[model samples]
Target: MSPASSHTHRPPALAGLELLASAVVLVDADGTISYANAAAENLLESSLKALSRQKLAAQFLNPEELDNICAQARLHKFSDLRQDLTLERAGRDPLHVHSIVSVLDEPAGHVLIELREHLQHIKLDREERILDQSQVNKELIRNLAHEIKNPLGGIRGAAQLLEMELPPLHLGQLREYTQVIIKEADRLQTLVDRLLAPHRRPHIVGDVNIHEVCERVRSLILAEFPAGLTILRDYDASIPEFRGDKEQLIQTVLNIAHNAAQALSARIEAGEAQLTFKTRVARQVTLAKVRYGLALDLHIIDNGPGISPQIRDRIFYPLVSGREGGSGLGLTLAQTFVQQHMGVIECESRPGYTDFRILLPLP
Candidate 1:
């Protein structure tokens, strides 16, 4: 049957299923698909016309389990059931998905099936944790900075007074100690200021062209690694300009690109380092628990020894770094800037490739 014919038979109340991020389908007691939403088509890697009237169990390696479940639902044995299933696709590896089957009263003899990728569920949970951690980090940093700032000034002042009160002969010998105290106090003060910088600065919103931001970061990285690294752009020109802080966006991209370049130091020296800036439009994206109709999908990819597994989860936390002498504020600040724009940043890394993705809502 044609896609239009199949869609016409779908109940009007089921139309909203198309807006969901999870794959959803309606099937009869015989396990034949009656309707598949857009997400379902994408998940199954098939079109509505192709999926219509097809057995849902046929798409999986363990077909009997799904068939049994559908039969039980049809017999009114259970109102809903959730199970983990493996879907086998031709020419692709098997996918692990969580399936929820709920009996439909309106559509008698039919059940609604929702499919969610296991990895996607993990990603969503991680994103939620990051958002919660970010809020806590903000509060902790603010209070810590305030606590340190007050004593920092007093320490510097006391060091100056101690230096002035020294005897003429002792002044020369003791001057170095006072200067050390004063200099160390100043350094600590600077550190405190940086900790609070993101909260202090205004957002400075304006029309932001994501491609322009990517180009700026690309140039900066190239300038720093002029000899070996190659920066590539795979941008979607159709992306519309949105309102945001241009400088903050630039810094966010730059911080992530710069970190990638730093990680690629060995590859750069070998004249094989390659970093790519990719941008596209993503629909039905959820950021910080709020769903957006459309969002910017930006990726900074590098061919380098990927992030260390030990610190991978804590890379966004303040004062955490994989590199020696690294302050670890780069990614923390990058995440902060992205969060300011109602977006989220995520990283996936392996032995040879690391990808940092930033998703921001579109106007």
Candidate 2:
């Protein structure tokens, strides 16, 4: 038979697999791959044409186990089977995935396989938890700020009144004590205002160029750290302008980058610090349980001592900080502003590497 005549055509029913986020593959009774979806192609790091040319069992390190599973499904022993397997790649790290095998009714010997990366599942779970926790943190902060604000004002007012009512003879000595009380109250009031700032400010909307925001932040950071740190830009110019608050977006990026720079102080002094601002367009992204066709994938990466494990999970919560003397409100406010634009921020950190990723929907 001619090469053209021997080429296998994919069944129309399999086209819908492309819409799914999970990787999917279809194999014949002989264990030959007949179809691979977009997600599958990406996971396998090969095109459908190439993947189809190879046996499905060859993709995994343990081929006999996969063949046996396919055989069981083909024999009608079980309608479905689930297992965790590791996929071997040519030049990349092995991918651990949870695979589900289902026997197709129409195709006598065909089996459908679905794959979900274990890390992706963990990431999705973490994102959901962060979203839920963020809501609770905001409520707690707002209520706590208001409660503290009322008592703070009263304390400051009473201190001032007592300072004024002090006798002229003892005023000099007594005034110092009242002044300390007044100053501490003022400081607490400032903290409360910052805590409530995100909730009080109106979101100003406009067409924002993410690169411009990055540039502004870059200039600011460089101005502060001139000698030791290196800030690299890896921006995709094809990203279109999106509707968002330019100032808020700037603040979001600034707060993240600034924290990274501060964390790099030790490395900065040694002249080996590095920070990277990366931007890309993410397709078929799901943020806060809502899927979007396109989204902004922004990363603020730094090489520094990683965030402490004790507070890593609570970094976005108000008053949580990894650094000594850190007010801990920077990341909290950053999360709040991003949420206002229907976006999400996620962090992954380990010794020598920390990545803060921000995902925002695009039009």
Candidate 3:
């Protein structure tokens, strides 16, 4: 049957299944898919129209398991049934899922399957662990910054005094050495201040329009790299204003954009660099141990050489940088600001593409 006719014949109750965050698929006793919802399409990484034309057993890594589940559901009748299964997709790695099987009573021989990827649980666990680590990092940074800050002022003062005491005639080169010490101290002081800035600043809360923030950052970036870079925006106008510190949000996005531009230096020189800011609404997202019904998904994607694998895992840590002469605090600050707003930031990178995804809870 054609996809249109196939969809029209699907049980009316299955319409509500599309609203669920978990992947839901309906199949006949013969293993042919009768219906697949949006979430199922996303998990399977294929359109419902395409998936409907295939068999459930063909899409699973262990086809026997799926066959048995369907057979058992049809024979003994089932509801709220649970199973662990693996899914197979073309050109992609197999995915482990927590599957729940049930018999749709209206469709006599139809079986309903709900699939939730184990990867989502892993990501949630990882995010929680990172949030815990961030707290520890902040504490350590505060203590270390204070310790270093105290000595830096004393060292700079001593260098200035020493320079003054040296004779102008014979010890001029010695004064230059003292000058170096003072200059180095100042640089260290600046670093210490930045390390403590997040803690020192007050979070000024207000309704923030995300698009305005993106526009501000885009204008600044274009002004800085007018010739070689293109800043593209794909925004969802339906996203509503949320409570946040607007300035902090702007800084957070700007920092990430600046780093992307810097990473695109080679592409920039060749005049092929592209940076895209895409915004969408994400539903049923968990951030920092709390589940949000709705959240803003802001993506900063760049087409450039990706992050170095050596430092990719540590990129969010303060003072960790993949590039030479980098202070390595931009991403750290971005993460800090996001966490302050009860949001999460994640990244995925390959050789030719890098995406920084920020999720902020919406009221």
- The candidate that achieves the highest lDDT relative to the unseen native structure: 1
Q: Give the alpha carbon lDDT tens digit for every residue of 1-363 in model 1.
A: 865586437677878987999999988767789898767876886767788758899999888988888888888899899988999975346899999988888668888899999999788898999999999998998999999999999999999999989999888889999999999999888888888999999989999999999988888888899988999889889999999999999999998999899999999999999999989877677888998877898989899999999999999999899989888889999999999999999888888888899999998
* lDDT value, residue 195 of candidate 2: 91
Q: In terms of TM-score, which candidate is stronger, 2 or 3? A: 3
- Model 1 earns a TM-score of 0.76
Which residue runs does candidate 1 get wrong by more than 4 Å? 1-15, 24-95, 99-114, 166-173
In model 2, which runs have C-alpha deviations exceeding 4 angstroms? 1-15, 25-83, 87-95, 100-113, 119-122
Model 1 Cα shift for residue 36 (angstroms): 7.6
Lowest lDDT sum, 10 consecutive residues, model 3, at 2-11
Which TM-score value belongs to model 2? Answer: 0.79
Candidate 3: the clashing residue pairs are none
* TM-score of each prediction: 0.76, 0.79, 0.82
Order the numbered candidates by lDDT, best leading: 1, 2, 3
Q: How many clashes (backbone N, Cα, C below 3 Å) per candidate?
A: 0, 0, 0
In candidate 2, what residue range of length 10 has the lowest lDDT sum?
A: 1-10
Clashing pairs in 2: none
RMSD of 3: 4.4
